[model samples]
Target: MEDFKFTISKFLKRTALVLVFLLAVLFVFAPSFSLAQVNTGIEFGAYTGLAQTDVRIIIAKIIRVFFGVLGIIAVGFTLYGGYMYMTSEGNEKKLETAKAILKNMAIGLAIILSALAIVQFVLNTLLNEYQAGPTGETTPPIGGETVCADCGFLGSVIESHYPGRGAMGIPRNTKIVITFKYDILAGSLIQDSNNNGQFGDTLGGGNNDRPSAAFKIYPTTGGESAAMAPNQFDVFLSVDKRTFIFKPKVLLGSALQDTNYTVKLTDAVKLADGSSAFGAIGAYSWGFTVSTVADLTPPQIESIIPTPSLDKYARNIMVQINFNEPVDPLSASGFFELASGDPTKNFQNINLAIDEGTKPLISGNFKITNQYRTVEFKTADECGHNPCGQTIYCLPGDKQILATVKSASVDSSNKPQAQITANFYDGVVDMAGNSLNGGGELRINGQNKIVLEPGVKTLNQWQAASGKILDDFSWRFLTSAILDTTAPKLTVITPGSLAEKIDVAAPLNMAFDKPMAIGSFKEIVLKTNKDFNINYTYFGTSYDALGQKVILPTQKAVRTTAEIAHGDFWQKSPTAPADTESAIYYPFAPSLLNDIYQNCFYPAVLQNSPRCVVGDISESNKLNDNTPSCFDLQNTNYEGYCSMGEPCPLVPAPHNP
Candidate 1:
């Protein structure tokens, strides 16, 4: 009996030791298994349906599995101890050994339970800390089992918002604007009592109805609880109903300088058809930092297209005026006017023109673009072919054209026009409600020294004057019979063709032989043949004072590749085989790029031509074994590469067009 008891005790001790050793091995190699799963893109745990491989989540899962195994071992030992006690068969020594084993099993079970509870508590605390970062701002949860009060799954209802996500140096008094791909239901944004898709409803107190909770803005430091009250802001919809503007009753970030603020749109927002705005993913949110100072500096004219007193100006050219800052689109569209013939006779009240007996000579459409800073006027008449491309519009030949931008606070009857708010004037105000400083001064050749009226230096002074025109701006130019047919051509391309060892964050620089229309460059496309998952983010496009040279700065490249037995894993594997890592510029399409004279970059004759410019971006002192033809990656049958000349054939004879 003594021998039997000793052997059973020895066997149990050995089994326990083996189990502990196995558990330790699993704990030690758990990270390797997790990484392997991540590399293979495998999903596990109850969140198997979610496409998440966050390291913290993986670690938590591993810990859970380890504790689960421990619990199983504890249960197994309890069962084995019960069987040993039941089979003891009235032997004192065997019964004593079974009782000891049962006691040990109970202690082990208690320890495992306690450890699990402690671990679970720690993990929950850690996840909360990770979600609410150092700034106390709760990051939008991408994928998780944790439930949040104001949180919902990610969605793509919003097209764009200003101040953009993670944007810094935002003005405190700036109004927030959100543009959606589809028209929104007005009632979803504000309390529309009449439900006419307009803000005409009034409460019994005679106050404007408050906005709905669909739109929220709050300081991130204080979380959602500190959100601005609905009554503290007013909502206005655009004429198209695709844009909603939120104007706070007071300035934002007033209590602190350089404060971070978050904007959220809940699922309650709906489309014009009454469908959910954020479809599957219920909500959308972003954060931006506001500056301490407000935008109090009034807007000024930056440049004019048909320069003042210029001779032989193209008849087909569009008149463009650029402002120093983004101006209210409403103000620009209503206050700018154009006419033909003498300004003293044909132009009056800065709005009327009598070129053809009360009929305006230049009847055309006004387009406000470049983020509302550029206003363009295209005449009603279309001219024949010009050097740039087909002429879109034309002016009368041998005629003097006059353009005027008014800075009046009131209309011709001296009554205030429609106001954006109680104190915000409607006539030529900036985004922050600062009126345009157009007081009798005209910016000619990018200088403010050209003062038309000596005493009118401010909008207020201009408004006090008796003249119909108060601090208005006017420029005169003569149109000739000759058409500017010269199209702008590419002059220089930085990191010239096939250049190597380029910095990942380097700006793509391109210079034009002549000043190109700044708006036309928006069509240019820059892409790389790296992994499809890896992408580049262009910050913004900037140009020299001449608008001839453009610089496109991009964010630094992200690290996504890792070396494995079969070459680079994430970047050049079988799934993503373009290992050359080259950046290609697809030639601008016809009619997409235009010169100042409205001439298309690629003539209509060459609209079907294939042209691509390639720039190698391989690492220094390294060569890729697989350098396929550029056309193979782009999937286009293009001719040869050309930086500044005619397009040539790059592929074999049959592939050439």
Candidate 2:
């Protein structure tokens, strides 16, 4: 009990001394406050006391004072307990209570000191550093997919770098380039017109009239694995601020022989957000192979004109075999000759010359052969030039015989070039095996006819006879290619006008510009009234298969032209074929009436025919006049009805026709 009391007394003495020192310092250096300043209700002395020190120093002093006061109270209890213990007068219970009080006071002081030590260590190590701003060691933004951490953000921040090609790779031996397409919202990039460094008024928002987009590239292979070469690489690009397409070119200098090179994009070349190089846009990467210097050969003629295979009417022609590459004039001249065919024409007597004075131009003549006889021809060549040249150039020879030298034309370039027009006078065919048909005499007047050879058969008789030689080959050739074999367009309506008045028994159906396909009209309906606003349903077949009949299908209860007319009018009904059937067949103009609808007995079938009619033989009315007659069943014969009155019941239903 005595020891515990002694410890508390010592702590109290130390605290009291510290308090006395603080009070002395305050009294010596503190300033006086004006009465007005003290009007805040705090004592002037307290203000004066606080005024002597800075805020930090004053705060430390305040804490010291609080602890000092606590120490004083603790000391007072301890002394009282000691006094009680000293006066206990041999009573053990009183002595024990004094010891207990002294023990609790000592424990309280120990707890306070321990907490102070912990707080001091934490402030020095953590809080002090936090108060300082970020140093050079601060972490910088790194490459990764980025998204807004805060709420209310709908758009994304993506990098625009393009991958060379296949995911995460590019050819190490070849150069590659990439391009991009973007639809970036311009509103997201430049909202503030006044602020240079800032985006929109709100952070991360901006005007996006033209948003940010870019592309980048770097080495993918060989550059790092082997010794690097100087001046061996260069980046050639066509790029704008928004997009990039670059080709890496390497000068294959002596250091590196022939080898492929490649480049790739890296993390360092990307934007802060690690998005694509194309700025949230589409991109593509492509590569091309490069080759050393080399030469190219000319195209070869696989077969000759007047194709070898003969057409039925094919005749007289001169054809040649071609070479895979340009020929050596001297060697080609000697080697090129018309091979065998009809004995009438031979190369032995024809003039042969080197036709290559003009590099690419070449041709020869077979005029020395029997001019009246047809001949088949072919030619071949011995290779001359070296690089990419052929040792022997040959082509499947095509043939054409000269029936006559009609009008001819040729390319202006320097070469023995000529185009011949002639009939298949002798029915001669060239090498490749195509035949010709007859009735195609040459267009030229004098060359149209040719004398037939002794044994040659004429196309007209399939025998050796000659007349106007035909050029069916050219005609068929043109007809089969450029000229459309499709049916001629029927653009304008037939009969030309729809306003002309005609008999009511039959109506002139409209026509179109093009030939109607077979079987295209099963549901054609004819209408009444000039503009076709009011109508009749003519459920009948088309008379001309090539005529496309337009129909209005839904109306089943429509009235006929006869019913719509105010006066009596009638004409004979005729069976007509529909558009579908017309496609496969053509109709001749009717011989009974004029094509002029207004001057015919039957309006519909009245195209280009003589006008004739059969009605009351006893009546004094003309059938072609406005008083045309209608058939009446009661009469059992053509009689009695007239066009100037009400319509007669003699008109048959359209389906029946």
Candidate 3:
């Protein structure tokens, strides 16, 4: 029995000694570990995985467990000292040993109590204005002072959150995990000091007045947020009690697949001894995308017109973007960047979070058409310094007709340059709910660059890699300053109006001197002598340049009374207008016609048209009126008063009279 007792005593003494050593080690290493980086301040955690916020919480938990062991050791010391006092039984040396043990314990207890009292008093005095909490817990500082994210209240500390700030593509069925940091507050997020061992029905939620709101997850514009529901999501604590998982009965069934879900950690959830996730740094909130199908594939820029190069491009060039698939329009807006210099080197990965305030260098609106697969941005505007945020306004006769990539590295001529960068960065998602890999980039010579040399002597060029879908297919082009004002003219017409027998089934085809505006051509009317109007329609027009005044049959086709089947059109009855002397052209509005430069059109005589025939006199009379008289003056006398190849001027006038 004595041996067994002595062995037990020895074990106790060793455990106590080891606990003291651990405390010493912790004190020495604390500063380094406590110097934790603030990871929750950002939005992207997938690249870095398993958030750094989790890291800090885990470290805190290990320390808490170690300190808990220390408390057990302290209790052991008190019991051991009592046992020795009972066994001493008036023995001088044994009594002295008992006295020493008791004295040590008393001194330790005194120190612990004094520290607690001083800490409480100082904190209360410093933060006296704050209203006491529901459970007499230490509330946040009274007046809106900055809340410390790392501070503990009473003796407990907990600070962890999820969807990890700006995390994206979170599965709709995944759970919301919040590290509780301690097991004492198991089924709740509040202190349980007075309850001893019993769990409570209600836990305190800080300022929001709703306990379940100590943490919440809601769609950006829907779900319980629109109509409040109590305790819709059930909370579960991990076996170790360091992590809290929130699970909705069903998966997020929000209105759409790309619904935004934000998880907010309110200051209401307190630890067992009473402290919220850093007492008043507002609410710790982070958002993530809720997608039904897991979209791991990234989106890429399929094509961009006026590619990155030193090739000449029109100043009024229409910027077009083609994606592999349709993307959310908002995701692709405000990310198109334009600059005069090499913005290539300074491009940044745009944050897709909606609240990110990064604005485009130029101002413009995006138009999505072609079934939403293409985005068009018109960059034309009035001449002004900084119009559309340009550093210099475009003016006529500028030496560099087009805007060119200019850098301090290049000297002399500021050759024409243009650069276009398109980003669908704000979580642009395809129909499949797959997000564009924000990783897509435009690289120039191992760097993100879209610099164009003025194509003065040679064309400078670059091509983005094709490995990933999100990679940008961006480019630079030399610019042109020329304005187009020449009007489009009809150079030829089929089915000559003077023909004796015109094929009633043949469609009248009019060719233009240039690629005439399709809208302008609609103004051309075919009318009979009876004035019955011929109705015709065309598909949308285009802006391709032209030279030889000949419109392809594909370019212009008239709707004959009997029409032939063609693109976006079918045949009409040839007898509909009733055959007559001719069809006259009257309603062609040149002023409404414009070239690619938005230049207005001017009227010109159509070489010939079935639509109109200008009035004219008899052919012989017209010829005589235009012909010059065949009379000449002779320099020398010749036979019969006329010389070969000389004018018989006097005789001719006398004969005419």
Candidate 4:
């Protein structure tokens, strides 16, 4: 009995030592396996093999397998003990040894099960935390929030909307228009019983289906609880699927005076691929006040590009007409006529000359932009070179150009006439269905007289009666023989280069030597190295009345927090420049800027040349012998801080030691 007990004790001691060695080895090598999982191409089933990449999942599986093997060993020991006891034939020592073995096996099995449960609980908790974001929301997978082009995932945003946020005095009849940055899923907008990506319903009719709850509208005082029913309003998606127009069954603010309303678009609105349109934001909402009165006034011409006084206008210039108010996009097409001839010619003679092919009416396509308030005419003839590598459209150089905005005449039946002659007609109207008021007195046959109420004659008839059309607007301009080949240059930077102690709330101002295209302002980017919490508000680009100089107040800074520090500050190095010794820094990229003629300031030819660097104000300035002058800092046509015809030196007076 004593020998038997000693043998059992030796076996138990060896088993425990082996188990400890195995556990230590697993822990030591587990980190290497974790690192390999990042780029591993291995594949295996969870039950039968190992396919999981996460280290935690892999460790859990390994531990469970180890415990399962131990349980199988314990069961084998228990069976062996039962067989020995039954075959002992009432021998006390043999039976006692069998009982001891059985008791130890049972304890080992219980411990194995308990350890497995604890490990599983720990792994499950870790996995749940990993899947959830910092805010405990079930967000996209790690690094999946970024907008990707080919991935079909975008940071969905509202580009613009009619009756803008906080807008007051908005016309009651104004339709709610929301333009999105990307195309949306049509089914998400309204009821699509067939599951097809289309609205498939008529406008302003009972047949139209109610839109989904993703879009909502309600009075400001009542909040979303008093939201209007989906059936009360009809939604129409634009042909491109980027814009949605919401038209209420009844006019807004019909009974109330200056009522405030809120419009909300929830994340339930989806992309074509069924992803949330609002992304992580969940919803977008804005409020506007609607006036009791409706918009009844006609849209008028506010300004025209290539003004009548600009005799040296570029031949490749595009004619732009700005309207005082938004007009119907359909009404703007084919109503503008451009011909080269004397401005005083009668409509009949001009039409005759164009019909007989004696005079060339510049053929071009019309594009309505600026929220349907500006019309641009791009001629078919291509000429000149745009430094930005864009195609240039041109008009006949060294010729007198006469531009006319045609007006319609009332027919005998008192209805607006559509087509009177090939080149003579009028259909330009505003969003409120009112005709264009070109700011001129009513005239017939060269006499100031009212022919009929709501039955105004055509511009052609009015021109024949008097020297001018009743409502037709005309302008004359001349084009130069030379095309605009000069690229726009940055003349001034508000905080100035290498400036110090700049206010945190000051606007970043940039002025160009010539007027730049407002649309191209998007290319100018601001970059920083540190993670600073700052909100930049875009104030939009603008030009002076003369249009000679363009001032781009790109952003108004709003400082939300104090400056952040990484480590030690104010390091001095022999190789480091004075510009690098700054507490806060922002770098400007002017290479992307372009002029109205599509000429780039820093063309590819000047990419290797020295360029001006807009540094932060907090940078320390120390005199360096190799420092370049303001002129030397410029690339190609960029003026930097130096004026035209100004002398430049290796070092400026301000930098002299």
Best by TM-score: 1
Model 2 Cα lDDT, one tens digit per residue, 1-657 = 567556766765665566456455544433221111111211122213443222333344455567677767877886887888799998897888787776766765665565445433332222111111211111221122111121000011221222211222222322222221232322222223434443212121222111122222223334534423322222221112222222223322123232333332222233324444332323322222223321111112221222212232111112322222222111111111244353223223112222234322112322111111122232233222111111222221232233221111221241112111121112222111012212232222244322212222233342222332332222110101111111111222222232222322224343322222111121122221111111111111112232332121111111111111111111111121111010000011111211111112222211232212332222343232233223222223222122221223232222100
Instruction: Name the best candidate (by lDDT).
Output: 1
Model 4 poorest 10 in a row by lDDT? 558-567
How good is model 1 by TM-score?
Answer: 0.53
Candidate 4 lDDT, 292-395, residue by residue in tens: 88765555566555555533677876666666776654446432244535321222211101222345566665545445555667676778544334567787
How do all models score by TM-score? 0.53, 0.16, 0.25, 0.47
The candidates, ranked best first by TM-score, are 1, 4, 3, 2
Residue 231 of candidate 3: its Cα lDDT?
46
* lDDT on C-alpha atoms for all candidate structures: 0.51, 0.26, 0.36, 0.49
RMSD of each: 14.6, 41.1, 41.6, 18.8
Candidate 2 residue spans exceeding 4 A from truth? 1-102, 109-159, 163-170, 173-231, 239-241, 250-657
* Sort by lDDT, top down from the best: 1, 4, 3, 2
